[model samples]
Target chain A: MAFPPFAVTVDLVVFTIRDDQLCVLTIERGEAPFAGGQALPGGFVLPDEDLADAAARELAEETGVGKDAELERVHLEQLGTYGDPTRDPRMRTVSVAYLAFAAQLSEPIAGTDAAAAQWMPVASALTTSLAFDHGQILADGLERARAKLEYTTLAATFCRDEFTIADLRHVYELVWDVTIDPRNFHRKVLASEGFVEPTGEQTSQGRGRPAQLFTRGDATQLHPPIRR
Target chain B: MAFPPFAVTVDLVVFTIRDDQLCVLTIERGEAPFAGGQALPGGFVLPDEDLADAAARELAEETGVGKDAELERVHLEQLGTYGDPTRDPRMRTVSVAYLAFAAQLSEPIAGTDAAAAQWMPVASALTTSLAFDHGQILADGLERARAKLEYTTLAATFCRDEFTIADLRHVYELVWDVTIDPRNFHRKVLASEGFVEPTGEQTSQGRGRPAQLFTRGDATQLHPPIRR
Candidate 1:
């Protein structure tokens, strides 16, 4: 029996927020087809692993989300597939792109086929040419993150487990790149049931009086979504 | 140099509303692996076509949405990828699933390898055994449709170009399997800016009175989403 002439690859658009800016994990390709250019950290799927497993494995190898991985702290989801026949010059390849978000990450460790890895600010990365169709994948990942914040508790993934309302608002401000009315943001978040629950503790981190700490609630979809 | 060991396929979960229920297009497989069983209308990606192009072609072939295709009227989007190495019995295959919605689609015409094609209510299709991992794909598609209704102008796709408030509410009720308060639904939908625009026409379709006509608006994402 003749096998279908095709190849499957997994790409990760890992996102993080550092220095009040949204950043994406990128690697310098050590091989041809845009060699030395920055690209999302990813690789071909193994015959024995699931697509998501391949994505996580590639993420671990490219970044350092290794064995001690606080997997739950990371929000990982399938972004979409990019399968333009001419996307890869060598062969007909279909790539399954994944979206991952977590708290600020340290520098990444390059894989065998990567020259180096680092977290690039989303703004700077969008202007640079990325390998293959990775630029499109990064754009889609960023949009997904922005949209998800409206209806899902995904924003919490970018913060520590215990955070104040201001800490959460900063996540929104940084990702959306807008300064929101702190009082309005706090009111909306508190009114949206299952969005967050007060921890009965306060944090004296930023200016003004200490703010109450809170954790993500049980709700996945917010009833009245916080509009962007 | 070695090629990646995998085949790429596209599976479409085409949905529509008919007889007050959400329906899915399904085909009976005429080939082995799961012969005589029902499956989503799809096939392996052709070497020369883009992933989405291949999906649209397969859709046209299996359901006769051919050339003069009302492609613009249909809302088609990539759902996600399913690649459990063992999901396919023949070889390691990665399948990209797509979700398509249109005004009530006619009975499907079977393609070369399908024995028959029919529009099955999503409720019934969920309980029936489908070939491969198609059952899971259908479920995901249904959920995507349900969720998209909350934050997008997608509900308009289910109605005719000019429709009444009752017609729009029915689409939501059918997909969500809930009875929404007609008064509240009308107020909420109208309150959301750019959700639907009045067309200066009325139709007495079902009963009672001739309702005002409206068409889909310019907005894609609803600012203050009409939450379910």
Candidate 2:
């Protein structure tokens, strides 16, 4: 019966595999709450927009990603909600955090009054100071990404449309931050039915033998997870 | 700088195993916006409460689980946030759904103006009508519970403090809605270190044998998940 004294926002932990490193898109907030501090790209959800739509809009606004490009190339899902009563200094703000992944990204052009926008490696981002509870949100999102890779075909989302087994393996290594056995990794990935299918064409990466290319298959849940 | 136009609420999907079936707690709404419809036990979150605290509070209020007992025995986690703009007829509301599990539970007593509250078999509840986006939330919660059993020792949360391997298997069978081989189930559960530990006691069920009792262990995740 009383007016709800709370606010809803959407924050995105937009991740990408770039140059053999796992990076997330972050912006330097231009507002009073931790102004000039790095934070996940996000803003308040509009009254009429869906949660996912708000996240996608904020992602485009902060990263300058074209709407079409974002819709076609990015994968987003609800991560979790954070409402700690005092999470926001201005009001009781409950943020629905989203986990997103994209293959490749260019330098960001800051929008929506963000002082700066750029891609920061997950490792460094974890160490850098962030606004509000964005630090914990980033940590949770990274763990989700790592755990998802073990049992889901999401790793392929971080690679080019046409990539080799090595390319897929690198995504795991970068995200998990571990050196997996190449032979074992190759064998398991190929054996996992509907995980990846060969393109029948091989591309030489250097002087060595040309590695066969493959694309993501239809499988969503891996039966035998690729353990870390 | 504008006031956030969204209202925040919490919905709980509390699951329990009873009579060889997985049941979820549901309450009949006592007010408009689908009044008298069966729904997951939930209400508007109070302003000063944390999200999880709000879920815990609502769980206790609607189900009559004592605060201390609920805090100790229940395992709760953020399932996901549902914000479809039109989910609530009153205004723009974003409900943070929570997934919870309890060992053995008694009949629920409706509280806080709920018309009635009771535990209903998940299968039957799925077919029955529910208020708001609760049906979708229930589906997601059920899938999460089923998947969690594969890798986490969460099934133990559905058993008594000290239970037999057969009792544990029944929890799996009931939640997954699939019968598992007794021998294979026992072997896999024990072999998975940190899944359960002997309690140095035994209990007799019906006219069968006296089975050894075991308690949940420290291990959170199984290396090789028990496949369904």
Give the alpha-carbon lDDT of every model.
Answer: 0.86, 0.87
lDDT of 1 at B47: 76
Q: What lDDT tens digits, residue by residue, belong to model 1 across residues B1-228?
A: 575678788999988888888888898888888898899998888779888898888888877774575777788899989999889988888889989888875654657667888888999999999999999999999889998998798999888778888989999999999999999999988987888999999897676989999998888988667667
DockQ of each: 0.73, 0.78
Q: What is the per-residue lDDT of model 1 for residues A1-228, given as tens digits with 9 covering 90 to 100? A: 465667788899988888778889889888898987899888888878999999888877876675585677788899999999899998888889999988876554657677888888999999999999999999999888898997788888898889888888999998888899999998999998988899999988767899999998998887777878
Q: Give model 2's clash tally.
A: 0
- Deviating ranges (above 4 Å) for candidate 1: A1-3, A106-110, A190-208, A212-219, B106-110, B187-207, B212-215
Using TM-score as the measure, which candidate wins? 2
What is candidate 1's CA lDDT for residue B202?
A: 87
Query: What lDDT is reached at residue B179 by model 2?
Result: 89
